[model samples]
Target chain A: NAGVTQTPKFRILKIGQSMTLQCAQDMNHNYMYWYRQDPGMGLKLIYYSVGAGITDKGEVPNGYNVSRSTTEDFPLRLELAAPSQTSVYFCASSYSGARGSSGNTIYFGEGSWLTVV
Target chain B: AQRVTQPEKLLSVFKGAPVELKCNYSYSGSPELFWYVQYSRQRLQLLLRHISRESIKGFTADLNKGETSFHLKKPFAQEEDSAMYYCALSGRGGDDKIIFGKGTRLHILP
Candidate 1:
């Protein structure tokens, strides 16, 4: 089974442009997250969803919007891309319903590289 | 505020040498720590967790509550071990968010 899948492995956007980064997981996980990694910086959470129809803002959610319409999908939208938005984005998922041990391990996708000019 | 710290930005060692990646964390309550690794052209994946205390790929991490540290160690490093390693921490109970460190790039030369 494909654990997690992300589309548009690479993309280039002009300033003020908008685009969506799609994320899908086949594991039926309850928790999904979007994170962006800049040079020499750790991953910063952009947005997250506990389950379908529920989404929340994360540490670096500015200029980004997220929606969780289905169990398998949670997409992140960049309203107006800026040079600062250029970075690598990753999507992750974890099963929260399970007991303590299994719930904390997060699985990440290959990542999407976005370049804003 | 909860945070994770990895002081070393880069670490290099010769193949077959011992390796250690240090991680320190700050949190009010009990925390769950984890080590994640990313190899070239590969997705970031969980290497180990403090809760599990299990070793994978000859790599192991120990959580020292007294020191507020969770350091990853391997007796013998291999060329394949070269990658970026991150230390992460999540609080107990209802806290689902995970805080990650800047990460350390480990390079094992032959």
Candidate 2:
């Protein structure tokens, strides 16, 4: 299985430009999340969805948007990109039906590198 | 508010030496803790979680609720043990949103 897959592993955009980071998972996980990792800082949640058709803002969701159109796909949208938005983006998913009971490990995708100039 | 902290930004140790990656968290209620590791040029993966109470890749982490810490430790550090490690925390029964620490980069010398 492909597990978690992300597209356009590397991208560069001008300031104020917009783009979408596509993510898909075959594990059929109910919880999906988008996170950004800076140089020294760890992953910061941008947005998340429990399942298809439901989404919520995360700790650092100011400049991004997300949609859970299907159980396998959850894409992140960057509007008016800024230098501050340049970072490695990771998409993750997990089966949460048995949360706090089982391993419930979160599987992450091979991150996408985004640079804003 | 829930927060995770890894005080060290970088740590270097020689091969066959003991290794410890410090991690601490703050949460009022019982929170699920996890250790995620990212090797050079590789995607991040789960090393272990407190609930599972299992050791992975010769690494083990124990949750100390009294100190709010879940430090990762290994007896004999190996060259392959070098990587970036992150400590994460999640609430008990919500959407399972996790908060990650700043992460520690462990480098093993030959």
Candidate 3:
């Protein structure tokens, strides 16, 4: 059972290069999130989606973008990549009831290691 | 704004020793705290949450509103328990996003 899947488990890019980190879930979860983990910064939220066609910015969404056109897919796009973007990115999903009234536990995917040289 | 603070960046304990990982948060809404663990070369996963008031893998956490802390504790730590621990806080509502603190790397020595 694939809980949450992220593509390009490892990647390297030059400064200013752009790429999209693909993320998808098979659990029919309504909430999806993208976060970046740095050495001392912990995990910083980049973007999130509540459901199909609904997306919002998180704590650190400056150089990143995300789309939720369907329930099963929520991809994060990074434009004009920079050195600070070199960190492990994680995609997570949770199935809270309507308005997230229940089951707030989030499931995380094996992270995508990206290095912006 | 919400914030999670994990004081210790690295913790070393002997096998079978009682271990405690400190965690503090600053949030005004009803607090929803959780402890996440990541073993060496493994993905991050949830260990326990205060709302459940339950123990997992011999670890438990209690939410203290007055102190604004949710520390993870284990009476007898095993070598297998050596992993990175993170403390997190949820927004007011359940579905709201979560804020995580810098993780603490726990090393259980023999």
Candidate 4:
């Protein structure tokens, strides 16, 4: 079902440039999230949405923005790329919150490696 | 002010030996705990959650509210178990925000 898909598996952006990381899930999930993975810092939540047309900031959301126009898509936008943003980004989704047993488990994308030079 | 800590960055265990990956969390209220594993060049996936109280791939973790720990353990380690393991936590109820630990790379040596 392509669980979760991310575009541009790898990308390099010039300093001060802007780019968007596209993420889509075919499982019809209601909750979607964007996370950045560094070498020693596990995964920091950038932004997340509970449903379509609803978005909220996460742990590390200062340099990024997000929009969830639909239930299947949650795109992360980097307005001004910086060298500090150079890391692996992952998109994930879950059917709901921590209510159920199995359905709430999150599914992740293959991850996009971004290098800001 | 919620945080998940995985004290070890890397752990090596001989084949058929017992294995344990320590995890401790800090949260004021009840929290949901999870263990995620990422294989080489693969997406991160859920290995187990504390709510389910079930074991997956021979791995089990018991939530200790008193100690605020949810450590993953396996009776016998296998080479196939080599992967990066992350401990995660989330607030109770509708809060889907899950924070993850730095992760521990488990190396099963033969």
Each prediction's Cα RMSD? Answer: 1.9, 1.9, 2.5, 2.1
Instruction: List runs of model 3 lying over 4 Å from the truth.
Output: A39-41, A98-102, B92-95
The candidate maximizing DockQ is 4
Instruction: List, residue by residue over A1-117, the lDDT tens digit for candidate 1.
Output: 799999989999999999999999999888899999886566788999888999998889999999999999999999989999999999999876354567477899999999999
> Which residue pairs clash in candidate 1?
none
Task: Rank candidates, lDDT, best first.
Answer: 4, 2, 1, 3
lDDT of 2 by residue, B17-102 (tens): 99999999999899889999999878998889998888899999999999999999999999999899999887767646677888
What TM-score, over all chains together, does every model reach? 0.91, 0.91, 0.88, 0.89
Compared with the true structure, what per-residue lDDT tens digits does model 3 show for residues A19-96? 999999999988899999875446778998888999999889999989999999999999999999999999999875
| Model 2 spans with C-alpha error above 4 angstroms | A99-102
User: In candidate 4, what are the lDDT values of residues B1-110, reduced to their tens digit?
Assistant: 78999999999999999999999999989988999999876789999999899989999999999999999999999999999999998776666566788899999999
Q: lDDT of each prediction vs. the true structure?
A: 0.90, 0.90, 0.87, 0.90
DockQ of predicted candidate 3: 0.49
- Cα shift from native, residue A15, model 1 (Å): 1.9
Which of the CAPRI classes, incorrect, acceptable, medium or high, describes model 1?
medium
The candidates, ranked best first by TM-score, are 2, 1, 4, 3
Q: lDDT of model 1 at residue A92? A: 94
The 10-residue segment of model 1 chain B with minimum total lDDT is B90-99
Please state the Cα-based DockQ of model 4 relative to the true two-chain complex: 0.62
Each candidate's B-chain TM-score, in sequence, is 0.97, 0.97, 0.96, 0.97
